[model samples]
Structure formats: C-alpha cells, structure tokens
Target chain A: MPKKIGSKTLLLTSSPSIIGYAAVGAKKEKQGPLADYFDYLSEDSSFGEKTWEKAETLMQKKAIELALQKCSVQKTDVDFLFAGDLLNQCIGSAYASRDMAMPFFGLYGACSTMSESLCLAAMFVDGQLANRCVAATSSHFCSAERQFRFPLEYGGQRTPTSQWTVTGSGACVVAPSKQAPYLRAVTVGTVADLGITDINNMGAAMAPAAAQTLCQFFSDTSTRPEDYDLILTGDLGFVGSRLLERMMQAEGYPMAKLHNDCGLMIYDRVKQDVHAGGSGCGCAASVLCSFILPQIACQRLKNVLFMATGALMSPTSNQQGESIPGIAHLLHISAFPNEKEAK
Target chain B: MTKQEYALWAQQESPKSKGLGDILRAFLFGGLICVIGQLLIFFFENRGAGEMAPVFASACLVVLSAILTGINIYDNIAKYAGAGTLVPITGFANSMVSAAMEFKTEGFILGLGAKMFIIAGPVIVYGVSASVIYGIILFLLG
Candidate 1:
C-alpha cells in the first residue's frame, strides 16, 4: 500500500515499475534532437488523418499500441488506462482510448497530465487495486494552436516567450513486476498562481508551480537536489526554466547543474526556430518515455525526479482576463525498487 | 517570497522582444508589401484601369495572400515579418481564409461558413460602425 510520507508526498511502498513505454511524434519532433529515441515518427503532422484532432487521437493510439507490443502485453491484461491531452474535454485521450475497451479515467492537468496520470496509475497499482495500468497523454501543434491561439495559417507573429506546441504522444505501462526503473514516490502539487497574465508566456506562468512542487518534494523526502541524478521539469522551456532555477536558488536548493527541462530537451531552439522552446503535454511525455526511461532502464541514471508542470487555464479564462494558475506533479523514479538503495 | 515579489521577478527574468531589430524588420517588410501594391497599381493603370487601379491591385494582393496561406507559407513569413504582414489587406484576407480552412472539419454551416470570419468579424463590425459615425460627422460638418 502507498504510505503518506509527509504532507504532500506519497511513498509507493510497492514501487510500481514502468515495464513498457513508447513515444510517437510528428514531423517537427522528427527533426528534433530526440528523434531517434521515439518509437514512431510520422512525417505528416496530421498522421494521414483528415483533421488535426483526429490525428492527435491516432498518434496517441499508436503510442499505446507500441508500448503494449514492446512489453509483449495484451490489451486485456491491462486493468485500467489513465490518459489526457490539451484538447477541449480531453477529446484526444478519449478518442484514443475509445477502441481499447479498457476502463479509462480521463484527466486534465494541462501539460502536466503525463506525470498526473502516471502518479494515479502507480497509486492504483501500489494499492493492489489493479495488477497493471497504462498512463498516456498526447498533444498536437495544429489542434492546440487553433483552439488556444489562432488559426494555423493566420499571419501573426509569435512572441519571444511563446513556445511551440509539440505534436507527439507518449504511453507507459505500470505493473507490480520487478523492473529496473521503479516509481518510488509522487508529490502532488498545489496550484500556484503568481498573477502572470500573459498568455504568450506560459513558461513564466508554470515556473512557480514547478518550484513549489520541487521544494515540497525535497522537504518531504528529507533529501537535497544532489541526491538525484537529474531533476527534470515538464515544459518550462527557456523562460520558465531560468525562472525556476532562480526560484530554487532563493529557496536554498540550487540545482543548476542537475536540472533539465523536457521542453528544452525536445527541440533545438536555435535551429528549429521554436523561440523559447517546446511546450505541450507531449513534450514531457515523449521525452520521459523515449529518452529518460531508457536511460534509467539501462542503469545509466540511478535516481531521478520527474515533474511535469502545467498552466491550468483555458482560452476562456485567459480571454476573460483571469490569471493563469499552474500545477506540477512530481514522481521520484529510481533504477532500483529498494528504498534504502535509492536513498 | 510573496506572490507580488515573485511576479515582478519573473517578469524581469523573462526575455524581451528584439526592440529596434524587430522594428527595422517590420518597417522593411511592411514597406516592401506597400511597394508591391504600388507596382501592381502601376501595372493596372498602364492597362487603362484608371480609378479601378487601386481596387484591382488590392484584389490581386488578397488573392496572392489567400494562395500563400493555402500553400502554408504566409505564417513562416509573418513570424519574422511581425506587423509587416499583419497590418495589411493581405493579412485580413489570410485571417478569413485560414479560419475557413481550419474549421472546415467541423462542417460547412457551423464551421467553415460561420467561423470563417471569426478573426476578421470584430474588425469588420467596428470598421463599418466607425465609418457610419464618420459619415454622420462629415454630413454635420458640411
């Protein structure tokens, strides 16, 4: 059973292992640095689908299938599926899981959905309520752009702080089996709004939430930043990343050397012309499943802290002049299931 | 730190626009677009377009904008061009065409037809209303 470590962190004693994982990306992602890590890459941003929304769904479905296939696990073996995306009503996850015929829990944590879903899945497995579960999330550039910002072909300039929404999907299968990379603990974050109202600067909006979560996790675990091999943030990109580092420094947890952001890792900012960096649910999701997990599995990385941050505001909220609230969910992953060894 | 303090710090920490460089690009590209319009007006006038030269040139620009938008090149140009592309007749046409193309998947009536003017709708409403106000003021002054 999962034990409450402190006020915010949940220590999963059972230590659910992510036995299978896969990442699927579109054209822009294919051109990025982590292209080779992705399980599947589609040149067409639409994934050969007529609509961008449908393409997002298809990309998510492919990721789920690839994950299951890699682990030699059948769909029937999975007890539950937790998924979400950036689309309205989480249609991306819903349509993706439609044909799966598994019990589905649709979540909405914005870009932080990958870790949010993973935390829930791990909790369910740790409690022995389910033998196995799948956590998945997806986001597409065109679909998000039309719904949140503007029409795809609209002639408008993106600001320096604006981030490109990544067209990608990532999935992971969590089970009680003893795997190399284990889910050790999870810190569910509270919403932190620093009163940032600029819709173009999501990184700034989400950075406060990430700092809050990381500080809380460190306090709860009685561990410092040096304890982990890497402290990975979801989609804070360049602006948010710098803000987070400064915040962490102020909080006396200077982790400049150990910290990295999925948004920054996914794309080459200079070459890709993606001003600030990449920002999407898929940005962290794909990076975790494809790049981070494999390194952990190979024993290259021993202890890691993965936290995905999200801006919990809709177009309506932003348009209504409401400040963007941000949330971040943290997962402490280790190469071994043994608690003492991890510590 | 307090929320107010953090907000101020974050705002300062975030990157700012390129300032003068961006302004220069906007000026150059915007001027280039106007030069193209002037050239088209000249060509139409040479063909005896007379007072219709400006209208024909505008139509040509709109059509060219629509084509660029269809081929998915206008956005890339606009990214560097900034206000250069946005503050023009071509930008207005691109707005309508892009919205129509995007919402087409939702269907014609509710999607393409209705939302075709989603971006340009507000501009049209205020533009026409202001014109009516200006006409009334002109009549009173005369």
Candidate 2:
C-alpha cells in the first residue's frame, strides 16, 4: 500500500497531449500572422536589429497564457510566478512575467530550467507557503546564438553534440494543499560538475552534469530506477544521453529500463537531422506539459521522475573561459488512480 | 596614454632591451595556450571522452588561461591573437584578471570590487534595466 496520512496529494497534470501544446503554437501559424521578425532574422542583416529579445518575450508570454488557460487558472489567481530563459539577464522570463503582475522570480538552468522551476514551485505548494504557483522557461536559437556565439551572418558549422536551441516555451501551474491535482514530492538539485566546459558543443558539456545529478537524486530519495513508471532526464539528447547511461553503468547505477531522455524525444532526429534530439529548457518543459501530463491524465503512468539538467554557464562565463558547471533537479509526480472515477 | 601609444612604446622599447627574449617569451607562452587546448581535446578524444571531452578540454583551456593571466603570460598571447583571444571565452577571463590586477594597488573595495563587474557591466545593466522597463509595461497592460 502507498503511504497515506493526510488527504493532501500532489499530481502532475496538463493538456491531453504534447501535441496539444504544440497546437497552441501552430494556431499562431494558422492565423496567417506575419512572423516577419523570424523571417527578418534568417535574412542577412546586422544581427542586433533582429530583435531576438522581443521574440523571446512574445513566446514566453504566449506559453504562460496557454498554461494558464489549460489549468483553468487566471493570472490573478496565481500567487507567484517563477520563470527563466537563456537571454542575457533572463530578459525573456523577466520581461514576459512583468506584465502578469505575479511576484516574479527569474531562473536559469540552460535546458533543465523547467525542472528547476517545477521543483521550486512544488516545494512552495507542498509546504503550504503558496496556494498557487506558475513556472515557465524558454529558449530561442536565434537569441541564444547571437548572444553566445557568432553573429547570424557568420555562418559557422555546429558539431553533432550541439543542440539547436528550441524555439519554444513551457509553463506550468501548481496549486497548494489541494487534496488531489497538486504537487507531490520534489528533489532539489545540486551542482554536478563533470569538469566539462566546451561551449561550442553543449550536450557533451552538460551530459556529465546531468548524469551526476540524476544519480545523486536517486541516492538522496532512496529510490531506484524501478520506483517510477518512467525516469526522464531533461536534455541529454542523442550523444549526451548515451554517455550519461554509460557513466551511470560504470558507477553501478544503470537506468536502461523505462528511461528516456527528453531531448531526444521532442524532435524527430532523423527528419530534423538533429543527430541528437531537442534540448533547451523548452525541450523538457514542452515534453512534460504537452506529452507527460496528458499521459498522467489518461492514467497511463503512475509515478514519474522528471530530472531536468542544465549547463550553468552563461555567455559571459563561457566568454571568460570559466569551466561549465551543470545542475539538475528531480521532481516526483505520482498519478494515483481516481477511486471515484475508477468505480 | 591611448592603447595605441602604449603599443607603440612597447614596440620601440622591445627592440633595444632584450627584445628577442621578450618576443620569444610571448610567442612561447602564447603558443603554449593553443597547444594545451589542442592536447586536451586530443587526450579526451583518445580516451573516448566523446561529447564531454570538449567541454572538459575547453574548461581546462580556460583554467590554464586564467593561471597564465595571473602570471601575465596571456597578455603576450593577446598580441598574437589580436582580438581572437579576446573574443573567445578565455579572453573574458583574462580581462577580469587583468582589470583586477590593474586596480590591485588601490584597496580591494575600490579596485577589485569595483573592477570585477567592469567587463560584465553592460550586459547586467541592460538585463536589469530592460526587465524593469518591461515589468512596468506589463503592469500597465495586464
């Protein structure tokens, strides 16, 4: 029997499918809206005028709106908003959240931002500190590329390990002490430095960081890989995820069964020629908010561990040649069978 | 003096006083940085470090550059790379250390404390200022 004392429960919930979330973005396309900004970006011009920050701002706002709409929660209903993105000084999150008027907190975890925000938001809900929480994270390739690497005009070759910055945003809402449909357990992440620092290719740079954090989370929580129906690592796409598994095996903590990397799952690797899969904070967030949440609603999965990994280096840090550090936070969302509904 | 004048002075002085030795030292140290980065990449690749190898190698390069910056070796390297070394991440580290050292004679607060944020100043200011403005707009609109 599962341990049950108080009637309070934490559950991970979202729209019916990941594609449903993608449909929100697709709607913008269907409207035949002029996305001239994106078009202007790919064209040859001076990079700064491309207005990447503006794009990041818009995407994040839209994501927040969708997540709120799905949760049946209004902006005013949320007590606080925790958000993050890869732009300079987290402009994407801060600027976007500014209008929402919820107490805003900006965060960064490279690709693993969603997990970080979720873990923090869940803690607030579980502790009864807040009644409602909203979290969002995003990454835009155009914005991140211009800030971190060469200008858009300077077409440089990206290596296989380099993950294309996801053109997406993910947002989630969690409510407090609500008996069901609430946050369950959360595992705060620790800095896991595998001493990797190649900025040109982040998957490898961040893989060891993700692996170390995942192993630590399991150890701390006293949970095994089989404890959950699925164990997902945020963004250790094709190469990094494989490397992470190998490292885990070497350490005698393998996760071969029911384990998937969100990075690889988000995009069609073969069609996209994405050697690895999707990455960025959006990769994990979109996967969870879109795909995993729907599965939970369907009662297809019971216990799930969402481990989001982040490369903690910034453009300034990378430029300064500081060693890239990484962090990952594991959040547990258990979907108990609704007794009434089951009957 | 302008940065140009300083360059001219160094050029003139080097020719008379052990110029060759200083030239050799700069070249040797500068070459050493590149070699170290290359060697790290090779070693990790050979050991099957795969994706992580580059991150680690780049990290090592940064650390090595930092130490060299401390000893004033990286300045010589800058002469060769011009802006190449400065443009990369390692160059940022050099700038931090170099700025800190320049102000070292002043007290820590006035020197290092004030100077640490020098290189990173613009980005931070822009980030915070933009957020504040955006926040105001959001408040008005929402």
TM-score of 1: 0.98
TM-score of chain A of 1: 0.99
Per residue, candidate 2 scores C-alpha lDDT tens digits across A1-343 of: 1222222222323201111222112222112222221111122211223456766777778788877775577889887788898877899898898789899888877777898787767666555667778878877765676556643322123444566556667777776432223245555666765555567456555656666666665665556777678888888776666666766776677776768877777666766655556677766776676667666556687667788888888777777878777777776665542323334
Candidate 2, superposed: residue stretches over 4 Å from native: A1-50, A177-182, A337-343, B1-142
lDDT of 2 by residue, B55-89 (tens): 98888877866787887677655644444565555
DockQ of all predictions against the true structure, Cα-based:
0.83, 0.02
Per-candidate iRMSD: 1.1, 21.4
Model 1: residues with Cα > 4 Å off, grouped in runs:
A341-343
- Best-matching candidate per DockQ: 1
Best by TM-score: 1
